[model samples]
Target: MKPGILVISHGSREAAWVKLVDDAVIAAAASPCLSDIPIVSSFLEIIEGRLIQDGIDELERQGVTDMYVVPFFISSGSTHVDEIGQAFGLPWLTDLEGDLGTFRVSANVRYGLPIDDDPEIAELLAANIAELSTEPEKEALLLIGHGSKEKMFHERWQEGLLKLGERLRALGGYKRAEYAMLLPDQAAAKLAEMQAANPGEAVIVVPLFLSRGYFTNHVIPTRLTGLEYRYNGKAMLPNQAIERWLERQMLEGLQRLNEK
Candidate 1:
């Protein structure tokens, strides 16, 4: 069976954001670990023409009979991941109503998961906040994510973020690592709570977004107004580790395809 890889991510209107994903995909494709299969990056929405359907059609045109759809999202708890999987004939597991309909597909799909608690992700984040953190023992990391109001989705975010926080703490030897969601607007409250709970520790605010966009640039900073904290606003993009993670996922998919 002819197989290909498709990385699906939440699209942003920011050119830099889109370019980061594309650059990672290109780097992943260039890896020697992967076979010479057609691979592309597609978005769930926002970007015109490069939508999920367009990606499917492009790969199908290349005579790809099987595909692995990898969720490039930060967390699998994202509702978009569930809906997009549903569009590819997976079960609609979420309680939220999805506006995305089924797409035309003739090839067999091998759905891949998101970057929840990958060690590479932990390393990437630790590296990202290395500059902001002076003393790991006296610092606390507060990861901010775009949380959901829905129970199931919110839980998913919590599960992933919690595990990720543990990993970061273990890797960086930080005093504490916690997360806050933007949807429920918990950034400010969480920071204050953390500060009160762990006095004398410097709080480092890290945004759990794929790229440095409006959320990382403006929303996060605005939410934490008047709060004393360290922030670099560096996102999970333009990192070699992420490129390796992408390649590793696609490589594992290739192995799975071969096993079948």
Candidate 2:
């Protein structure tokens, strides 16, 4: 049986946003280590025709009987992550309230972890922020997340961002590092508060997101409009580190499958 991969991401209406995710998956699949593997990328929602079920069907059509699904999300605590797990009939670490509906595929499927607070990912985030921090000693780093508004979902988003914030803080160059969500009425106030608290310090705002899209480009900037901070609206994309991370996950998945 041929082994294949299905890369899942949160779908977007913006063409640029979808392209970013597709590009990353294509680049990662091109790696020599991932050679000959049929890797299909799909979205959770929004985009028509290229949904997660579509990805599964594509893999099955290609004669693949064993499939590994790699969810390319920023947080493990994301409800989307749980929803994807349930879609694959896999037990989740956290209870997900929403249903993405049921999917039936002939291929045996295994799920991969989201881009959680992995040490390597922390390094990637640090690199992205370090470039924005002109003076690490005097600048404060603020990481923004696309948190949920729903009570159950919001808590998970907060939990993951807070943990990531701590890791990013420990990366050690900044005066202070904090995280805030776009929802639950905290993002703008937090940004304003950070700037006010450190009158002279440069507040570098980095988004805790997977790619540069509507949220990173439009929403975040609009929310921080009156705040005094430096934001280039950079996201975690066009980085080789993410491909490396995916490769590791695939290899780990293969190892686990082999063990079983």
Candidate 3:
């Protein structure tokens, strides 16, 4: 049973974004668990030939029979996860339809979940904001995510963020952890609410994105135009935790395949 790993993320036109994912893949491939296993980093869209189908084709060409398709997304709530799953003939994580179309998947596909509420991810978030957090115990961590209007997806986003917040709050010893989504444009209101609710707490805005890109740079800040919160817009990339997460996914996939 030849096995391979395909780590897919929502692509960006920016070279840095793609490079981060590829670099993480390189980091993950060094793990002892993945020794001699072929691993490819693919994108949901953009980045041309490195798209999901292209990655799958590359893996199959390498004679991989049981391929582990890892969804390197921030939340299980993402519509892209559903679309990607649908594309690979797996059950959708949401009720939404997939527009990504079907892929010519010849390998035994085993789809993995997203990075939702992981303990290490919570650490990554805490570490990302460590510089901005002068007094963590007196600060309110406001997590900002690209949310969904769809009921199921939105609920899933909140669920994951809620758990992640709990973990981060404990990890950082912060006063509290709050969340807002750029979608439906709630960053300003959430910021206002967090400040009001916490009174003397310092609100620290953290973008719950995979990497630093358009959302973290432009969209998130624009949504908080008149807000009074501390923000540096650091995202979850160029960090070693992500490589550990990727390696975990591949290991779990191999374990599942062996069980079968």
Question: Per-residue lDDT tens digits of candidate 1, residues 32-67?
Answer: 656579997899999989999999999999999989
- The true-versus-predicted C-alpha distance at residue 163 of model 3, in Å, is 0.4
Error of 1 at 8 (Å): 0.9
Candidates, ranked, lDDT: 1, 3, 2
lDDT of 3 by residue, 1-260 (tens): 89988999989999999899889989989988788898988999988999999999999999999898899999988888889999999887656788988999888888899999999888898888889888887888888899888888999999998999889899989888888877667888988887787677789888899889999999988878876888898899989999899889989988987777
Model 2 pairs in collision = none
lDDT of 3 at 47: 86
**lDDT of prediction 3:** 0.88
Which one wins by lDDT: 1 or 3?
1
Between candidates 1 and 2, which one is better according to lDDT? Answer: 1
TM-score of 1: 0.96
| Per-candidate local distance difference test | 0.89, 0.80, 0.88
Question: Residue 214 deviation, candidate 3, in Å?
Answer: 0.9
Model 3 lDDT at residue 168: 88
- Compute the lDDT of residue 240 as modeled in candidate 1: 91
TM-score of each: 0.96, 0.90, 0.96
